[model samples]
Target: MLDATLKAQLKAYLVHVRQPVELVASLDDDAKSNDTWELLNEIAELHPDVSAVRADDDQRRPSFLIRRVGTEVGVRFAGIPLGHEFTSLVLALLQVGGHPPKLSEEVLTAIRELPGDYSFETYFSLTCQNCPDLVQALNTMSVINPRIRHISIEGGLFREEIEARQIMSVPAVYLNGEPFAQGRMDVEQILAKLDTGAEARAAEKIAAKEPFDVLVVGGGPAGAAAAIYAARKGIHTGVVTERFGGQVLDTMAIENFISVQHTEGPKLVAQLEAHVAEYGVDVMALQRAQALVPSRSPGGLHELYLASGATLKARTVILSTGARWRSLGVPGEDAYRNKGVTYCPHCDGPLFKGKRVAVIGGGNSGVEAAIDLAGIVAHVTLLEFGDQLRADAVLQRKLRSLPNVTVLLNAQTTEVEGDGNKVTGLTYKDRTTGVVHSMGLEGVFVQIGLIPNTDWLRDTVALSTCGEIEVDQHGRTSVAGIFAAGDATTTPFKQIVIAMGEGSKASLAAFDHLIRLPAAGEAVAA
Candidate 1:
């Protein structure tokens, strides 16, 4: 559909940049739109350094074609890049970038084999900046492959649709006519869900008959500790976890947890699980607690429903669900995570020994990670997107005294670059001067704050404005039968020791409450 002269020029431009280019057009014959094919041809001729091509006939009629010039990649969009359709460009670019992105092989294969056309609609708000990364990730997937499409609608723009879909929060994604996923999602996860949807539906139908007693949400230190204590008390305790070990599992080596001078996160989790298993704690992995409901009776009996349709009942509840690391949501950050990217310096810092690394964030965690890494890594670059470090003066002093650490204020991460399988470097832009520069690094650790896992409790329990469940000193939630602990609660310190301490206290409190209930019930019956 494109003019040969323009296509030739675009091909030349791509060659100049040494990247690939792709032109994607819609397949809907009845759909009215501009002549994207002709426009691409003209652009191709105008920018000969970039290559232009069309999707193969067998690949599907509505799909696009991708061609690599040298190293640079370009996309000629046949449709608006806004909304759900924008994902195409991101996918194409990722393909041109020579990385498969962060998708599982099985899911990727499934997506490749999918035929016809399907679209995903995600509803979100501008206030939810977190939603954009998810949108971009989906878009990237759609671009590389034609079977998938993504659309993001601003919640405000589609208020009626959002209400009808029951979208009470930001970042809710829907596939076809059914709700697919919500909140922050990576490409791999999205693909996996798509591939397993049928199986998941079948499993859900089967799990509806079973229920649990004392459902301990989360598998982090606090949740694990709670489950162990509850099981030891002879309560039928079960743990439903989206992922085992919560945030702590992502940690490399924890030196601060008392009694254990240095221990790997996974190892620690395994030990915890072993102890928990001794008491026969029912461990359910890869499941999330979607909601909690209190009994209609006066006495506090609660029910917990999981996303998988499994229901749980409890005389008393303990919420040890932890928090997650907040991301900068900038370009390349997600793509490079764990490749040349990391969230836990204590886990991955030593891996960068004798190599350059960057630590993004200026808070206490960032300062601490920088200080810790400076001693092991060859050179450490600390970037603060703010005007100054928010860490205490003592930590700031310690960071400043470190010879290997270089702190840059008002700096922002622009992109992460990698060499095929791993991270090679990153680019940072100066907020004040608007100048961008790239630095080679073996790794980049992101230490930006955390978000409590308390969104689902909004209606069931009282939560702080920041989404932390409010609890008494003894970790008792406002609800008489419900208790909370660790990072999920409004605790000041988020350390492992602190979380464990809270778990112990909450368990003791729950035991005391349980003890009182039976005696009072006997007296009432008499």
Candidate 2:
């Protein structure tokens, strides 16, 4: 099933495999084992350095052992790696065979201090963009310490185990049979789970923060950009976020960020965090900003409360809390999320290549997604709830031009029909005919609208009717010392380039506001 272009790319990447890697497939009586064996044999055919070896049912049931030719890190995949997760399988082999482990000293120390033997059973889907990150991080830990082990299980291939665990999402990590995390995670997050010391150190750092010059609320593209810009002004800036990457971590491929032709969401987020680390900004991660209390007096410090009961004071604040994808709220949609139902077309579209897929929504995003998926998938079915599509004329025209694309108007998606394993079809009601129909497809993409993360700031700042924070041209909100940017604000566009520009503007405006501040002594008395 590998295309020539993709095969070429795999060959190029395989050349860097310094040591021989073995794929020892332990087969069972299950039918899925055949599928797994087929995929592995195909992989072996493409790369001279990769060899597939089959084992009888007595050895183990449907597990692929991946290790260096001579050494064993005990790396095993319990499921077939398809879709976006194929990259994870490739990286796992390269990481195990190519180079020495390059984990930081702090992470290494935390691994060495593990209380006991820990194993991570990470359940994932081949189409899930976020699953590989957790799997790779956990795999690295296993390579460093023999006590730690991880098994990557593809949710589709191993349906029985996933159903037993009641898993409905990707990156569902279980530490020693106990649930650890459900979604995208970082190395520090995994470390914190392994030991309480990591969490304690983070809490201590957050509690020790005092008043600062600038405070950026979110840690997405806009917030990270704002923090870097503010710190460059030689001010003691602080950033409080639930996570360093914010919504960007949930995203997949980002093809349009300027200069860089192609990049994924996690890669871009890593770069953002790395760039922010170059400055002196106090980054308080894993803390959510719960409340905003304006300064009592002009030029005084504003008190920002976190969900952890910790309050941080800042002279100025920038709100860049990003937005989230709106769900269809249909039956089976939630149950099959990350199973065969995905929200990002750019990130997971490649996984559905040559497979029939459907895009739900008639807006610009839906049409755009349909157009994008048409090139990759065998067929694209676009469903619109309204009598007509809400997308722009130009986009609608472009969508109609694609031969493989089919648009259905006045179609209300009622339920996503899926087996216990993956999506089987889409069921929708035709408003015009009052008839419900099911279309067979392997994947479904939901592209309705973006819900801004501005509910928390409604009482503190001016918000649009749609719940986006209202900001002027200078990114200034109704509050004097507060500014907003990016998707959370009233910005017309929600692209990464636009968000970065907005962040730069907001930081510069915050700097300007600080320049007009009175002396420290006079500010307290005001």
Of the candidates shown, which would achieve the greatest lDDT relative to the real structure?
A: 2
The TM-score of predicted model 2 comes to 0.77
Please write out the lDDT profile of model 1 over residues 417-491, one tens digit for every residue: 886666788889999999998998878888889999888899998999999999999889988878889998998
Q: Determine which window of 10 residues in candidate 2 has minimal summed lDDT.
A: 517-526
Report lDDT per candidate.
0.69, 0.83
Model 2 clash count equals: 0
Best-fitting candidate, measured by TM-score?
2
Clashes of each: 38, 0
List where candidate 2 sits over 4 angstroms from the true fold. Answer: 1-72, 78-104, 123-127, 154-169, 172-180, 193-201, 329-342, 345-358, 368-381, 390-406, 412-444, 523-526
- Clash pairs, candidate 2, are none
Q: How accurate is candidate 1 locally (lDDT)?
A: 0.69
The 10-residue segment with the lowest total lDDT in model 1: 71-80
TM-score of each: 0.54, 0.77
